[model samples]
Target: MARPDIVELPLAGAFHYRPHPHHDHRGSFSRLTCDETLRDAGMNTTWVQTNLSRTKARGTVRGMHYQKPPFDEIKLLTCLSGCVYDVLVDLRPDSPTFGQWTGIELDGAAADTLYIPSGLAHGFQTLSDDVTLHYSHSAAFSPDHQAGLSYRDPQVAIRWPLPITALSDRDAELPNLKILEEAL
Candidate 1:
């Protein structure tokens, strides 16, 4: 199998990976993930669940979501169709870069994946219609442990590339950073 090229992001434990895709007359084939490569990078996370999300409109925002300890998850996200501006925020209070955020553009054409470690918030905005995202998670979903920060919270202050055109009622009702900090 071909090895993936992993690029570390500014935030600790976050990575952008591009698999080595082989091109032939019919099409191309690539290994999306490799245990050896992940082990080499010290990111051998055991994924227990896989999820797929499809967004039909541009400027649609989803998440800034994470779960509390014991249920907090590590995610590997990839764009399956169309494009998106993926974002992540460091939520580990004890870490040096806590609350800082970074964004990356992912598209189906490039077939790159973003790896997000535990203790971080993950979200994204669709840049094109009919965008699809695939996720591999280390932990199972737990409603009781689920928590989120408002995507528009001033404290987190994410500058989404495009105007937010859509958001769920639950996401719109998420608490701000101050409240989250107090709870933490």
Candidate 2:
């Protein structure tokens, strides 16, 4: 087994887990997550669900999404195949970096994961075809709690690497940062 080198991101509670793969005659292996490791790093450890996401085309954008109130969750997100430019915004009202955003390029070959704390909006732009992602969440999905800001929200102003090729109607209709704050 391998332990990931947990590097905290710019945002409070965000982290980048850089795993070192151990090589052998067969292949290489690494550990993605561990309770002891997470606990040592002061991260939430009670993951209740795991999910797999597959994106078939490059230049597709998904989210700027988060849950609200009692349903807010901590997420462990990893790129498993292909590449993506992952982005997130600090939506926590009292945080010093409130409304600020940050991004990182995640490569499947690196076998790394990003830690997203509660109250941050998370999204990604596929940088290669056939991208696969793994997600571990601390809470169950709740339609009523689901909310998002527009990917094109000028306030956040995310600089996606490629020209976007696809966006779902739901995402296209998400509200702006101002609306999110007012509604809260």
TM-score of each: 0.96, 0.97
Candidate 2 collision pairs: none
Residue-wise lDDT of candidate 2 within 30-133, one digit each (tens)? 78888899999999889998999999999999998999979999999989999999999999989999889999999999887999999999999999999999
- Residue 114 alpha-carbon offset, candidate 1, angstroms: 0.6
Q: Pick the candidate with the highest TM-score.
A: 2
Model 1: CA > 4 A from native: none
Q: Residue 16's C-alpha lDDT in candidate 2?
A: 91
- Candidate number with greatest lDDT: 2
lDDT scores in order: 0.89, 0.92
Score candidate 2 by TM-score against the native: 0.97
